[model samples]
Target chain A: MGRGMKRWMLWLPLAVFALLFAVVAAGLFRPADRTVRSAMIGKPIPNFTLPGMVPGKPGLATATLTAGRPHLVNVFASWCVPCIAEAPQLMRLKAMGVPIEGIAIRDTREDLLGFLRRNGDPYERIGDDQRSAVQVALGSSGVPESFVVDGAGTIVLQHVGDIRAEDVDDIAAAVRNAK
Target chain B: MAALCIALAAPVLADPSTPPAALAYTQLRDPAQEATAKALMETLRCLVCQGQSIADSDASLAGDMRSLVRERIAKGENPASIRAWLIQRYGDYVTYDPPLSAVTWPLWLAPIVLLAVGALLARQSFRRRPR
Candidate 1:
C-alpha cells in the first residue's frame, strides 16, 4: 500500500473504536425506553362486563366507562404490594372528583375487602377480574396499572405501575385532556 | 446412595408454589391442532415475562395467552390471523418476529449494505497490480 493508504489504514481501527465508543456513550446517556406503551391508547376500550367484587357496588361494564365523563380505570389486586402504595394517591384522586373504577385481578372478596378497609375505598365501581380476562383484554400486563378513559370510552392514556404522588398531577392532566 | 438420590429428588417433587395449569395450557386432544397451537405460541412474547415466549413462560398471563391461542387455532383460525389479533391488541411488541416497517427498514438493509461494502474493499485490496 502507498504511504497515504497506509496512513489511512492506521486510523481505521481507531475510527471504528471511536464510533463504537460514541454509540455506547450515547446509549448510556440516553437509555432506550423500556416501558411498553400500550397500543390500545386512542382506541376504544374493549367490551367487558365484570361482576361486582364488593357488595352493593355495581359491576363495571363498557357502557359505564362511557357515562359522559372521563374517569380512571385502575387494575389492581390484593396480592400486589404496589396497590397499597397507590391506594392513598387513588383516594386523593377520588376526592378531587376524578371518578375511579377498579378491576380486581385474581383476588378474593375477603382479601380485597381487608385491603380496602386498611387503606381506603375510593372506587365508584369495583369489578372482579378473577381470571384476568378483562385485564388482558384491556392490554394491561400487571397490577396497579391505570388507564384514563375519555367520555367517549376511548383510552387516552395508559399508566403502568403504581400511581405515585408525583404522577398524580400528570394523571390528572391526562384525565382533564381526555375530557 | 439411595438416601442421597431421594433427597435430591425430593425438592423436584415438592414444588408447592406451582399454580394449577390454566385451561389453555392443556394441550388439544388432536396432536395436529396441538402442534399448530404450540408453534404459534412459541412465536408470541409473554407480556408479563418479557424474556420468554408464551409457550415457555409459566406466568398466568402467558397461560391465558396460550389458552386463547389454542382456542382460536382449534376454531380453525390460522396462526397468522391469531398473530394479527395479538399484534392489534398489544402492538408489535407482543410478537418475537417484528414485520418490516418504515422504522425497521434500516435494520433489514444494514446487513446487505455492510456486506457489499466489505466485498468492494476486499476486492480493491487483493486485486493484482499491473506489472
Candidate 2:
C-alpha cells in the first residue's frame, strides 16, 4: 500500500479506540446530582402494602404504616455493609420511641429474618421486597436509605446511606414538626 | 499472528482470583472529604465495568483508582484538586464529575449540537434538486 494510505490505516484503529473511550468515559462520569437527589432527598416513598414479615401478622400496607402519624421508613438489605453499620442507630431510634418501619429490598425471607435476628430488630413493621419493586418506586440508589413521612403521607425528608444517631434525631424532629 | 491472539486473550480467559480492592488507599478522618470521595467514586466509571463506579466495582484497576484517591488525600490534596489532577492525567473519563469548562463544552452540548447538525444536514440534503 502507499505510505499515506498505510499511515491513514494505522490511525483508523487509534481514532476508533479514542472515540470508544470517550463515549464510555462520558457515560461513566455523567453527573450524579439528579440520581443522588432523587434517591436521597426528593423522591416520594414507595407505594407498597406488602405482607409484614413479623411471625403472626399478614402484611402491613404502606398506608397502614403511614396512616395515623409521621413515621420513619428505613430501607435496608442483607448484603449492604452500610446497613450493618447503621444497625445500632436503628436500634437506638426504636429505643427512643421512633415509629420506625423497614423495607428489606432484594433479600430472601430467610436472609431478612437472619439479618434482623443478628442485628436486632429495630423495626415495628417490616416489608419483604425481594424483587426491589418497592425500592425502585422509592428511588433508593442503594441500601440503608431512611425517609420521614408525615401523617398525610408526604415524604418530608430522605436520608441516603447509613443513618447516624444525629440523623435519627433530625429525622425525628422533622417528623414531629411536619404538619 | 496465532501467538499474538493467544496472548491478547490470555487475561480474558484467566481465572479472576484477585481480591476486591478497597475504595480508599489511606484512611480519611474528615467527614466532608470522605463524603466527596464516596460521591466521586460512585460517579466515576470503572474502566473495566464502564457502567459501575470504582466504589461499586470489584475490578483490580478500580481498587487502584480508589487507593490513588486515598494516597492523594493523605498527601493533603483537596478533593477538588485531586479530581482535577485525575482529569488532567486520565481525561474527564476518570471522573464521573465533568468540569464545567471550555474543554468539556462539547460534552455538555453534544446532544444539542448533534441535533442541530443533523437538522441542518437533512435540510441541505433534502433541498429541492433541479428537476
Candidate 3:
C-alpha cells in the first residue's frame, strides 16, 4: 500500500470507532421507555374484597371502585421506600378531592398506622393485602403503583413507580382522560 | 440453562400445605399440578426481579404468582389461557418469550444481517492482503 493510502486506512478505523462510540453513547444518554406492560389499561378492575385497615370500617370491595366516578387505586406497603416518597403526592391529590383507595401489601396495621402518622393519611379507604392475593388479582407487580380508573371501572393508565411532584400532571391528565 | 432448571424446581419447595411449615406458603399440591405450575412459571417473568423467571426468583411476589398459577391449574384452566390472561394484564414483558411482530422483527433479524455484512467485509480485506 502507498504511504498516503496507509495513512487514509488508519483514519478509517478511528472514524468507525468514533461512529460506534457515538451510537452507544446516544443510546446510553437517551431516556428509555420505562413503562411497565399493563394489560388492564382498557379493562375493568378485577373483583376483590379486602378487610379494612381500621377497626369497625367497611372492607374495600371491587364494587366500590366502579362507583360512577373516576378514582385512583394505589397499591403500597409501609416497607416500600417509594411509597413513603410518594406519600406527599398522594396527599396532594387527596386534598384536590381525588378519591384514592389504598391496598397495603404485606404490611401490618401497626406499620401502616405509623406510616400514615409519619407521612399523612390521604387514602379514603385502606385494604390489608397481607397475602398479596388482591395484588395478584389486580395484576400488580410491585408497591406504590397507581391505577387511574374511570367511572365505569376501566383502567386508563398505570403509574408504575413513586409519584414524584412532576408526575402529578401525568396523574391529573390520566384522571381527566379516564372521565 | 441453570436458571431454567432452578426455576422448575422452585414450585415443589413453594407449596404451602402439608408437613414442614418451613416450606414456602402456597396452596398447591399434586405432582401434575406442580409440574404444570413449574412449566408455566418458567415462562412468566418475575416482575419484581425483572431478570429471572417467577420459578427462579425467590421474591415474595414471585411466590404469589406461583400460587396463582397453581390455583389456575387446579381450577382446570388451560395454561395457555392463563398465560394469555397474564399477558393481557402485564403486557408481553411478563413472558420470557415475546411474540415476533412488526417492532420485534428487527430484534430477530438484525444480528443475522450484521453477520453477513461482517463476513463480506472480511472477505474483501483478505483479498486485498499480500498473503
Candidate 4:
C-alpha cells in the first residue's frame, strides 16, 4: 500500500505540470484583448511639459489641456505606420474645427516635421516627447492613440489604435460629450 | 524542400527595424533599494508582453519599466507607492500579485485545489491496494 501511494505521488508533479501547461497554453491561444485597460480612463490627464517640435512653435503643457473647449490629444510618432493610415481622419477632424494637439513620441524634430509635411499637418500645437514619458503617463498603448479631454482637463475617452473611417463618429461624439 | 522552408521563414524574419533593445544593466545606486526594485519588477507585468513580468521579460516595454523602477527607487519612492502609481495608471492587471477577488480567486486557489485532489487520489490508491 505504501509503494502504491508513493508511485501515485511521483506522478503528482507531472500531473500538476501538465495542468499548468494546459492553463498557460489556453491563455496564450485565446488571449485577452491586447489593449491593457488604462487606469487613466476616468482620471484627469497627467501633467507634462514637453517642448515644441520646432524652435519657435509652442510646446504642449498640462495647462494647455484645459483650453476653453474640448479637444483631441493625439499621440503619434514618425516611425509608427498606423499614424500614416490615420492621417486623413485627423485632417477631417481638423477641417471640422476640432482642435487637435499632437505629441510626437520618441521622434526627432526633423523627422516629425517631415512626417507632418508629408501627411498634412492638422496640429495647432505639437509637443516633442523625446523620451516617450508623457505618452506613457497618459496610459497610451502606442502611437496613434487619441484622448478626448474636456475643458476641466478630465479625460473623457481614450481611443486606441488607428482611427478608421468608422471611428470618426465615436471620436467626434466623445469630443462633443467632453464639451 | 529546403527552398520551400527558406521561403516560408523569410517573411517571419523580415520585420521593420526599430531601435535596439535597451538591456544595459544600470548600477543600482543603493543596494538596500535594489531588493525592493527587484521584487517590484517581479510583480509588475510587462505591459507590452502580457505573458511575462518585467523581471522575466526582455521586451522594450519591460526594459522601460525596469528603468522606471530603478529611477523611482533612486528618487526614494517606496516600492508600495510606486506599485500603486503604476496600478493607478495601468490597472490591476499590471501586477502578478493581484487582490484575492472573484477574478483572481480561481487562479489563487488552483494550486491548493490541485494539491488536495492529488493527495486524495494518492490516498484512494493506497487504500485500494492490498498488502
Q: Give the candidate number with the greatest lDDT.
A: 1
Over 4 Å off in model 4, which ranges?
A: A1-31, B1-25, B55-60
lDDT digits (tens) for residues A39-93 of candidate 2: 2233344567776765753554667645668788898877677888899988888
lDDT of 1 by residue, B1-131 (tens): 99888878833221112243355558898899999999999999998778899999987778878888888888999999999877877888888888899877897899999999999888886785543
**Which segments of model 2 are wrong by more than 4 Å?**
A1-35, A39-46, B1-131
* Model 1 chain B poorest 10 in a row by lDDT: B12-21
lDDT of 4 by residue, A1-179 (tens): 47998899789989989999999999999986778757797688888888887666788998988766888999888878888999999999888778899998767777777877899888888898765677668876566789989978998888888899999888887888787
In order, candidate lDDTs are: 0.85, 0.68, 0.80, 0.80
Fnat of each prediction, in sequence? 0.34, 0.00, 0.54, 0.38
Task: Flag clash pairs in model 4.
Answer: none
- Look at candidate 4 and tell me the lDDT of residue A8: 98
DockQ of 2: 0.02
Encode model 3's per-residue lDDT on A82-128: one tens digit a residue: 78789999999888778888888877677778888899988878887
| Clashing pairs for predicted structure model 1, backbone only | B24-B67
Rank by lDDT, highest first. 1, 3, 4, 2
Best by TM-score: 1
Q: Which rank order by DockQ, best down to worst?
A: 4, 3, 1, 2
lDDT of 4 at A69: 82
DockQ of each: 0.27, 0.02, 0.27, 0.28
Docking class of 4: acceptable
